[model samples]
Target: MEKPNLFSIATKELSQDAFITWLLQWADDKYKKENEHLCLLGKEFAKSLIKLDKKLNAENIKIAKVTAGRQWKNIDIWAEINDDYALIIEDKTQTGQHDEQLKRYKKIAENYYKGERKVICIYIKTGNECNSSLQYIQDNGWYIFSRSNFLAALKAFNTKNNIVEDFTSYLDNIEKETNSYQSKDKLKTWLAAQGFYLWLEKQVTDWNEWNYVANPSGGFLGFWYYFTACKKTKGAEIYIQLENRFDSGIDLCIKIGADWERTTEHLYKVYGILFEEAKKFNIEITKPKRFKAGAYSTVALVKNAFTTTSDEKLDLEKFLTVLTNTENLVAEAALKC
Candidate 1:
């Protein structure tokens, strides 16, 4: 019912390395209840324990343990606090394995008869020793704490209630800030690399003026040129003059559809919508600007460099159809759009 000696915790001399070894052994010997100590723990606690240790070092809090009320079958330790709270300590040694640990803790706490069970698992990982590892563990998600973090918790505040509030704030801040971050389009690039050809085939067929966004990782859009048609005139061999520039860039010049060219204003307004539409379908767009050769550059024949077309087909038709399909069966049939 009273606060214990703070001096002992302040002077608690235990090497982290030694403590980690002992703690692992303790989980098996003192902490284990059954045949295998199969409810494994380690690197996780090393991580969370670090936080607790730091908190202890700072004289903010101290680790307190009670082997539960000794009545429950599954639970081994009831460490944390009581009346009005209890932190359920589990070691999330592996990425997502700690799910069961917390589940079991909740199960024990149901019979705990000691107010609300504010549970947090301490995951000490000797293998990983940085925020990234902690983040990796978190991405897999188990409400686990790293050793350093657990120690940090101890150093900041001593009371169980204080620890709960502090830890809650810590996590809340992390979520508010860290949850939005992504891995620089790692998942997106992976998908693109996998089924890129199929995507290109699909994208090229769509007219209706759409955008095909390129993946930053795409080193020269390979396998995308087959489905694309180059700009052409009424009757001459209309070479792609600039292959690989627009949707229809090829290593060899070919008669492809014209590039979609729009005025700057129309381009911006339509671009956002088309861009969104393309993204929705995972279509990749080219950089710089793609225009019908007439708008920016002359549609000069690659071989002759003199012949020109009266009316060339632009590349936007398929995209427009996809965005707003008008039941053009021939374009659909030929391109397999």
Candidate 2:
């Protein structure tokens, strides 16, 4: 008999009540057989991470690792993307890891930072234990993922299976299915079987991270090519972080004009260049319409709300001139330095 996935079990035809009992029995058998003290978990996880990359990217999004899988004490998969950056992924099967995992990675990533301001760490865990190990994994200020997450993972899986095919059909299915009582009962049973009932209530997700090194040009680079070439659709998100250190960053808003339309030869560039000459430069770069909490509105907000090119407005030009001049000076100084 073949192993049943969450969907097959949920949507499988069987009595609502007895099906739940059968599902748990199956999960217990499979969980015990495979997870036997989390055996072969590392290999399983490495395989899944490769799949996750393929599911996340919708376009020609690139992904790779700077390093290959070596049985390091605290790390697992190390890869890269776009030939421009790297992602260090560590997978654990059981509850979690010891406290010093991320601290240990310092020795590994210290070598890979070739003045490249881009990198990420991924953790694809079997269980949903989010504590210090994972927290510290992220606190080091690296991009991390424990798992693809439940909803996100499901959506990706469905897309791969060609279940609903498009967004409209997906939404329609959601509306039709979630409203009925039988569906809810089947779902509850499925959750209970997998030991995911309480976990679902708590909203658990999979993310996990760490670091290691061997040869950037050898196996590491080979794995990088493996991930980048096969998996094109990858999901990514970027955000800033501050932790009572009084560190400040600048804010700049942008509009996706040509990038979204995929037209024109010019690539719109947005990068931060801090000017030591002009302070009070800690502004968060964002799109024109998005107003962060506690931020005062600019004239651009009131009048040119719909327009993306708020750069053309008057007051914005003045304020931006000061910022650009500062950035230009900083760039010049850096070049000189």
Candidate 3:
């Protein structure tokens, strides 16, 4: 049996925020005598935030104060270093930024400091997200502290503290679960499917957006790109959607966002173009037996979309080629319409 971990049970964002706050608090000089290792680790974390500013040298920089949660503008974590820099961390587990919260948080921090200290905003996501989401964070002026980056910092300390060890172990386990798709012959769990989606997000360069869509039946990881506006319907567009449920196959579909009448019209137009283009690439995409019309409806599908290796493992390269070819097909078809 696996050993019990508090973090594995207290998996909420509040729990993670508390852990980060506790670690950052140890950076103060008062904690050096209590536990030297923790103090050093805390200081290292403080440095990680400070190092984001090219003008600021984190070496020999001393932390003045550390605050977390409700104490300071409801920010997840805040650290004041040497009267010159204020680091604000907006921590997230599986959620993405909404309601322009990143911009709002940065503005709040800057206004609070009022030009006295350089406010550095960091967005830390410990869970999996698509590259497009990460890019959006960067575009909004927040430095992204990813899962791999956090793991690298924690592993570097090699501390014996039980709290640190447990947290590290928990995070490492999550990382392994998300990466298990590489070795497994099938996508057997939600984490494995998420891993596969993340991998595809990284490999497919032409996709405009990718995210997890929640539904009553079950959530699906969806990728959308090659948007072609419908010439007939206003505020309607047709795009290629790759929906993966880890059921040993991917649904390569052409979807539209409009009412049923316009959706069917746009879907068929784009579907016909893709059908012709796919043949040239030796790809097989067939019309679904039945088409449903709704806000987002699938008009066409590519059956058995993924190619497999001899041992029945996923063929990453061949599958990627198919996806890229599909994108090309959509792009070419968009021009004609």
What TM-score, to 2 decimals, does candidate 3 have? 0.88
Off by over 4 Å in 1: 1-77, 80-87, 98-101, 116-143, 147-337
Worst 10 residues of 1 by lDDT: 299-308
lDDT for residue 248 in candidate 3, whole number 0-100: 46
Name model 2 segments beyond 4 Å from true: 1-74, 130-133, 142-144, 147-154, 157-337
Highest-scoring model, lDDT? 3
Q: Give RMSD to native, each candidate.
A: 20.0, 21.1, 2.8
Put the candidates in TM-score order, highest first. Answer: 3, 2, 1
The order by descending lDDT is 3, 1, 2
Model 2 per-residue lDDT tens digits across residues 1-337: 4333443334322222122122222222234454432222222222334444443442443222223433444455454433444456555533354666755664476555664734445554533343534566667644344333423433433222232223223333333333321221232221221222222223222231112113332211000000111011122111111011011211222211211222221111112221232234443232234322211111111112111133332243344354343333333323322
Please report, in order, the local distance difference test score of every candidate based on alpha carbons: 0.32, 0.31, 0.76
Kindly report which residue stretches of model 3 are placed more than 4 angstroms away from their true locations once superposed.
60-71, 183-188, 228-237, 247-249, 257-273, 335-337
Scored against the true structure, residue 39 in model 3 reaches a CA lDDT of: 83
Question: What are the per-residue Cα lDDT tens digits for candidate 1 across 181-288?
Answer: 122122134222222222333544322111233444342323212223222222211112222222233221222233444245433433343334334443333323
List TM-score per model, in order: 0.24, 0.30, 0.88
